[model samples]
Target: MSVIEDALAALDLETKVKLLSGQDFWTLPAIPEIGLRSLVMSDGPIGLRGIGWRPDDPSIALPSPTALAATWDPELARTAGRALGQEARRKGVHVLLAPTVNLHRSPLGGRHFECYSEDPLLTGEIGAAYMAGVQDQGVGTTVKHFVANDSETDRFTVDVRVGERALRELYLAPFERIVGAGAWGVMAAYNGVNGSTMTEHADLQIGVLKREWGFDGVIVSDWTAARTTAPAANGGLDVVMPASGDPWGQALVAAVRSGEVPEEVIDDKVRRVLRLAARVGILDGAEPAVAESARPSTLDGAAVARKAATRSFVLARNEGGLLPLDPARLRTVAVSGALAADARVQGGGSALVQPAHVISPLDGLTAALAGEQTMAVGARPPRTRRWSTPPPSATPSAPTRAAGCRSPKVHSGPTSPVCSARPAGASSSVRRCPARTSAGWASRHPACHRPTSPSSRSPRVSRPPWAARTSWRSSASATSR
Candidate 1:
């Protein structure tokens, strides 16, 4: 096959054609279980997150973000970009879910590493360079967190409550610049702006992102992000990420059919997604299929992964002249903590990833120490002392687990039905992340269950008829009924 044809063959059949063909192609029942349209999607932004067939713990990589920024080397960022993009390509991924450029508002913010910087110039410059490299090889780049996704604290339902000036100058500036730079995709952040959910906010998604910026790209709702169909579409969200479940697609389809949302809005999204397929070479068949076999490690995403990992690793304390560890005679490296064993590469909530393989620092060190004997220890949560199995990996040792953020009540698992909410007449959502669920929102106020495929467009509420539910009246609303 010619390079284009070779690339084309790599793409799933769904992504290998235009709207008519692509839609039919995507909607076809090639797979018996679900909508395994010939083509499936992989994530983007920082990297491709691989999820296991049966769901696993959230695999979060250490902060490689600020590490790349510290270098201030556009080329290195580009290299990281290329490597990540290549990883997506090898995995048959049509869209890469990354290069999250939300302007860092505070250092304490958990996702600081995943995003670029606080300054628009630095963030935009590096982001633009990164996207160019990623897209050049046919894979698409999705610059994200839309506006103000900097902090993880109360992320889902909290509104940033920013003014027009703050929103325009800082939060949305980098996105605008990157859009101008030919970024093919943009992701809506979970945070709300001006008392509106980013996913369902029309003014920002359409007025600002599409019309003012003239971004002719696909706008995918961040995982499980869509709260309502009408505003979400009118606001310009195209392909909803992780497609099926949630307050997204199915709810959207229902809204359209019920006359709650206009048909044109639906077509607009379809066209954009289809157009994206063509641009990314998915339509031409250059895209790889989303299968285990697709991620063939030629140069081994290892070499590249290592470099990316290194860049992402912040040399926080060179205090005792540590690190750039001298394998020759470093004597013994004492490792501790839960992170030491399981290196969390991504975050919880949406952007969760499942890499093909994870080489924790402990894993790397053990291999390095194989020749030379080393002391080991394995205590619960580990001591600041030793390790028995070369230790897993090491986070800042300052408590990897967030002290406050509730381990959120989400409903996902084989036996668990996907849960969500919908408008009165709308179909229940396929999947709804509990983080986005409001305290006293709806009739069911139920977490969404994956709606029946030929996915239900009929709205369903969670409350069983007999349950007398009471509201946890908050300070936000001071009403007594």
Candidate 2:
């Protein structure tokens, strides 16, 4: 038996029950007695978004999975994976919830940008390579959305009616490859596969994944995916993410104690969790064990992102071979569209990241052609959506009359600033943006402005919670643009 197995055998039933659920949103509870440390997981198929959703914090943004697949090269995928693993390590994350291997069954899929290809073979090969690369860095990779989670429409409750043969041939193909590649973790999807919810799907979890393919990795429920205690627990789900207020807490423990669910089921799930912990160096005094190694040398992500973009471009058509023009022969290049000046690096959604810098098409062309390029606003897209501050209400009864209610410079949006208020000789008091506070407090609140004495250092302005929900898309967009 392995050392992890030995540790598992020593644990009692109560502690084992605790292991079956997460301690927090992004991590599992640690048992210091057994030397198991809390394991931190993050979102990524392309890049890591640490525990918090702070867009300002910098993270390496690689080419999207579709862009990586467009290259049709598994080697590049592996290189991208290595960079991702290194970034995960740098951020103190042990597991990356990535390599979304679900096949692209339809174009309208909201998360198609995050997936690899419509063809299963390509997704499988690329996913295997990416998983191998990530696991190589002593960080675990989660081959996610177990089966038939192709589209985001009705993702949480949509019951998919797929034929068995087609499902096996296409949908389950990538997962089989990822399991064969020995991914350390698997995330069950929110949608239902066939008639059964994936989180509680017995056949897929116990029959196909665990028995047939021999996937020993931990099976984590998608955030709030597990709906019931008995079904999900018996169905083979190991952990519930965002640990607070989950269905399987004391309820699951009580069910096990009442003989409604066997204790062995909980033991099996705990074993898988511990096994993953041991592999990722979370178990104290246990040597870190990776299923595979990607490469010995660390890779530069920014350099790879530039190179991958070059190869991933698909030339659908070129009239009269008007392509690959010699830089010397070209005098002045004419470019159009605002996107030429500002490129969208990745699609928006859960995986969105504000990269440190993105080189627009205009910048690239200018650099390549020795500053010989001119741009024209042939037609600019209408700014249908923008977040300028509500023009300071002309009314005198507004909140501006308060002691420190000065409006800070409003840029793209009103970044709610932390306000400092002092009355008479009393100490200054600070309060975060009270926009959501009671209506009565907004107009007369004295704590709504900057410090009395502004310092040389700029005060950190924070975007409101609603800013994360705001997103826009242009009608015409190009990879280079």
Candidate 3:
């Protein structure tokens, strides 16, 4: 038996049971007596959010999975994944909750940006490459939303009714590749698959993932996903995240004492978690990782983000071959739209990360053409629909700028190009715009208006203005011609 197995054999029933659930939100309780360290995890597919979950603690913001999928290059995906692993290491994170391989079943799916293509083949290939890269860096990667967690609508309770053929062909295909690639962990979805919640699905979690496919890694439940005790433990769930009160705790202990849950089940769960700890080099006798110094060195994250962003661009519908604009021939090209100066690097929700720097479409154009272009902040993306992650608490983190203010100022006279707007869907002062500095009010519009800073307690002002506006449409039109 391995060290983790040996340690598991010595643990009492209660200690083993405690190991099954998280000690608190975002961390597992460290079993100091056994020399097991608390393993830290962070939310991400595009990038790592780490524990602070604040904009001030910025992380590398790479292209979204959908953007990476558009590149149709597995090597590029692997490179991006390696960069993610490096970021996790810098942030002292043991596992990254990423490479969300769920398919794009519906356009209206709240998290389409977090996933790859709708096609299973593409999702599988890209996901497998990403998994390989992350594991290569000695940090564990969790391939998530196991089995039909495609949408966010009533995600906790909605039942996904899919046939076996469809499940294998579509929903499970990407996860299959990730498992086959030997991913260190898998996260069960909040929703139910067929009639049983995924956290308690014995056939898939145990019979298929562990028994048939040989996924020996830990299986962690999505936060609060485990709603019951005996079933989840018996179904092969190894960890309950966020350490809060959950389906597995005193209740699980009672079930085991009553013979509803076998001792072997508890042992198996503890063993798997211990296995994960060993793999990440956190178990006893393993050399502890060197803590990153204050201001850890960023291993060329900017270069990786740039390469991924540049390669992921697909020239769809270049009609009339109006090919790349020749800077030599163009005297003055007028670029319109606010997003031209402030690009939307990624989509909304938990996948969001505050990038160190974002090079806007206009930024690239201006640098290339030099004196050959004029930018006009004409139309913006539609604002009718809002894409936001639900706040975790009564108050959310203060907003930060996703892209710098690229809004050009034409102060020919008092009739300057200006319009007054407030924070989208706000009742008060988050409405006031700040001075013309980077990460200010211009995130939404290019108006030359200045107001006092909003209260710090307000939610983060991070909704990328380009998210709602047709910024890309305008950029493509201007550049191609």
Which of the predicted structures, 1 or 3, would earn the higher lDDT when compared with the native?
Answer: 3
Q: TM-score for all predictions?
A: 0.61, 0.76, 0.76
How many times do residue backbones clash in model 2? Answer: 1
How do the residues 104-202 of candidate 2 rate in per-residue lDDT, one tens digit apiece? 765456677889998899999999989888888888998888888876654655667677888799889999998998899998987776667788889
Per-residue lDDT tens digits of candidate 1, residues 35-135? 22343445445556543312352222323565667667677667666666666566566666677888666545656666777788788878887887677
Ranking by lDDT: 2, 3, 1
lDDT of 3: 0.70
State the local distance difference test value for candidate 2. 0.70
